[model samples]
Target: MTETTPLNDIIASRIARQGRITFADFMAACLYEPGLGYYTSPGRKVGAEGDFYTSITVHASYGRVVAREIAQMWRNMGSPAGFTLVECGAGNGRLACDIMDFLAEREPVMHQSLRLVLVEQEPSLESAQREMLAVHIDSLSWLSPDEFASGSFTFSGCLYSNELIDALPTHRVVMTSDGLKEVYVTCTNGEYAEEAGEPSTPELEAYLKRVAVELHPGQQAEVNLNAPKWLASAARALQRGFILTIDYGYTAHELYTPLRKLGTLLCYYRHQTEENPYLRLGLQDITSHVDFTTLMEYGEELGLQNAWFGEQYRFLMSAGIIEELEDLERSDVSDEEKLRLRLTLKKLIVPQGGMGDTFRVLIQSKRVTAPRLLCQRRIGG
Candidate 1:
């Protein structure tokens, strides 16, 4: 039997009062329901002790390479004196720390002008972020996600996120003989179950049309209406700068292929992949693959240009991973440690059962005239 959690009871009560709720609503509650949610009530969420590993956990080099890209972005924008670096979903501030450390040491001018605004949904994480980013205390600031997207916050520097969009609540749908039907959650016998019905919003159908996707009969897919909405807000806040998004996903054509009958919705717990999101309630992390096509298309509509889009490996390799590896070799670490670190860095760029191809990087810009980014260079050129 699946164990019941405090969030389970809260979600059950919500369903009892609201009849049936959309899967998106259930997922949002599971992930962001104040103190009981998985992320909001986190206890080490992104390392060996946590449910999963991200590129950041692999090595500091990942963020350093990203930092290199951001430095180049600063130069591309004429090195604005008051550049603000905003990181949405800044978890524990590890990446921000690494980036700031690199800039402080190497790109001192840009670092001097850099102001990092962390936008996190969980308020309690601010302490952890502050502690992690203590060295750059003067450069650090915090903002709630709502405030960051409220149209009041504007910035003229790069905004970046790693593995963020996939966590936003996604509406699941299945192609039935009748038509596209939304997956809804209902409580029966005090347990959660799924039922398909008319979509709660017409935007679901319009989303598929925007991507030109047609699901085969009985094929299940997740429509992330929230991703585009988030992009819209990000675009609105960027007066003249770039948005760098790194996450695991595909273009709309690859994501909604008929072969992938079951959508990419997944649950992660203790490093194990769970097919059943209903089992753990808020204890496990539920996420779906981001759709880059929608981000690109919707970004254009929001007056942002798709500057670059490619796999993580290509971005890292072209950006600065090789130089980072060379620096590791020049360092005074033991030979065995160097080899170990080399292998660890390989995990970030190797394809075939690795994070390299699975994760993608999207760079979008606004009001930048022919902005040339490091990731746009030819690999090995």
Candidate 2:
């Protein structure tokens, strides 16, 4: 209850009986287990009080910037009278709050016409989102994945998620002279250790084949089979809209560089990032940097076009964040509140030692071309 109690024990028991579990299994239990997983345990997982932090939690302005972008996107879509705006993995609803606030203040009509859906699998978090959006209860709706994935819902407008992809279950592999070997977990005297299992899943083998990149010998990397599936599902669920993904990662070319032997698997505990995911069990957060190249390419295969890609900082800047800051500076609010807002903005925009550099944004569209997006320095630009 205090830490990752029940889930950790469950995983440890599996390790005790079996030699070790696969990294994917370990992560799935740690993060998505019925009630004991880190995400479901109800501790601080998004703010400073939690084990890790996200940009939206850092500042309300982060969400405000996003809201502005969404507004622009709405206009680009011809301001559909009943456009759908879906936010999956809507953690803590902070971003939703910001966007809602922006709508109320800026585009009241669009706010009224919009249909907002917050899709979260966790009941506890769903309850939290309900509380956060109580004022807009009429416009907002909540659904579990089971409800939405039942193949009954159709959405159009925008599909957005922040820091969602990295959490998907991924198969871990280490490249050796002998070729790629999966890193599965095993039990050793009641403790868990990793051992090589098999080559790769049939789908994973084909994914690697298409990406056509070779990992350095002894390099350990994560391959997320769930990512493409998730995106594909989003594409299917969405009829005429854009799928916007924001995460940390590189293209395949940069990810599998020869100079870099270690892959992008990592863990975070009490805000300290580390390489060993086997420690602390369900108490800490485990994640892999997303491969945007995989997302762009795979999503495109599903009829989504790569609209744009850039760092979070550039995206926020392009959304007129500076003007928002200046407005806040001139507002009737107290200096203390203004200072706090500025600090939050700084945390989101600082190029080094900040979330801006740590995060990247990939925008893909369906049935539309790229609009005049701002503040992005593309890879080739």
Candidate 3:
């Protein structure tokens, strides 16, 4: 018999009271149910101590490269006097600190006028973010997800997130003989199990339709209705500027292919991947591959132009990774440290068995005219 966790009991009680609930709701509870969730009651959720390593954890150069692009974005917007940089899922503020460090050192003018608004769902993490971003405390601010989407808070700058959409509670669906059905969580004899049922909303079907995706019979997939909804709120908040999203995912064609029958849903615990989300309850990280097609299509409808979209390697290379490397080479660090750093940085750009091709960067702009951003530059030229 499987040992039940505190969260497992909490969830089971809810199921007993509510009968059955959509998988999305179950996932939402497992991940964001106030204090007991994996992220909410966090204990070093990122880096070597945590379940996984983000691009931010790999090296500082990745953030430096991203900072270069933001600097260009400010320039593209005619160097606005008050440019707001909002990071939606700013975990520990490492990326924000790195980006801010680069901007302060290189683009002092822009840094001087910059206001960084960190929109995080977990309130406990604000303290860690505050400490991590201590140097830039004067330029920092905070916003709840509700406040950000409330339509009262608008900004004229770039908004970005890393691996955020995938973590948003997503509805699971499977193609059936009759049509499509959503996966629901039900409790029987105090044990949780999955069952197929009518979709919680019509938007699930409409989402696939918007992306022109057709699931093969017996194929399971995740529909992140929240992704588009979040993008819509982000679009409303951004009066003029860019939305930079970095995540591991594919276009609709690749994401919904017949070969990927099991879907991209997976869990992480202490660096090990678990196929069963039910195993760890709220102790593990639950995520799925984002569908970039929906973000692009929905972004277009929101009046944002798709400025650039491609592999992370391309974005890093074209947006000043090489310059960062050159600077590293000229630094006073020992040859041994330089060699180690060089190999570490390769993980960010290598395609096979690395973050390069699997992770993608999408830049969507609103009211920005023919912006020639740094990431759009040719690799060699």
Candidate 4:
């Protein structure tokens, strides 16, 4: 692929004039910059033809199962009449469709109480979302932080996202034999090159201290400054509700281990993983694994009580996902529909080659009583 991305030009020119740009700048440009960035552009990001597959794209049951869990959370919150279900980074509205469809069928009362909100940043994705959700646009509202903040957004329901956090910009740093240095991308000789810069800011140093705890010498890792910011913002937006985050990542200790020397930064294009994000700047998707520990800690600091955390498979199993299958089987459904249902159920919880272990689920609540959460450790004592 040619390295002629407009985003790269803008970023490279800035780096050329300013010496070095932080990984955060690089990431933001590569993913969110105007019309040329990967996420900001009109491209298939999640699905068979896309760079990766999210649970919602894998099967509709993913959203259905998640909706059931949300219903349970609503019930735990006394089944408030004006509950909201806000889905962040809603791509193509597939998840919303599945969740609302299941809720409409099974819990019509709670479904009627639902005010669905999709908070997406990119206009292209939002346009696509509107088209995908045209039939249900009346029931759903496209929202942003400002729009969500306009009202007394004290949610009595769940605020959820899937495969969302990993896409946030992160700072990549390495502890070399010489000392700590930030990684910077530069156009050198003829191609994009990576060089070490000075130690990151004091703030970054402190973040690294926490992230690099117990890390052996020369270990490399990524710091998601945006993750905590997002959590804090979410915490502020939600006056009273649960924050459900689902993503693929490890704890801080694991992410900073010596074995992870090259860090978790990666790119995906057409379902294939690539290490050279610069090569396919606008065409591919750039992502880093999230630090679950960071998310949990920051969320708690923002008054979001840690409710539960577990592997996606365990979460699904505990949320009675299999019961949905049994119900489908027992119902007088058609043979084809039953087969599809069985296949979807298998994809969700059947462990090997399925989403069971690959994804994870974390639920945190604010101003909510400690309720027994399925598939997770007990809520705050």
List model 1 lDDT by residue over 245-270, tens digit each: 99999999999999999999999999
Instruction: Please provide, for model 4 over 29-138, each residue's C-alpha lDDT reduced to its tens digit, 9 standing for 90 to 100.
Output: 88888788888887678888787888887777778888888888888888889788888888788998888888888998998767888987675677777777676677
**Clash pairs (backbone) in predicted model 1:** none
Q: In candidate 2, which residue ranges exceed 4 Å CA deviation? A: 1-4, 15-20, 334-340, 374-381
Off by over 4 Å in 3: none
The window of 10 residues in a row where model 3 has the poorest summed lDDT is 1-10
| Tens digits of per-residue lDDT for model 3, 127-170 | 99999999999999999999999999999999999989989999
Candidate 4 clashes: the total is: 0
Better of 1 and 4 by lDDT: 1
Stronger candidate by lDDT (3 vs 4): 3
The C-alpha local distance difference test score for the whole of candidate 3 amounts to: 0.93
Local accuracy by lDDT, each model: 0.94, 0.79, 0.93, 0.78
Candidate 4's TM-score reads: 0.91
Least accurate stretch of 10 residues (summed lDDT) in model 2? 372-381
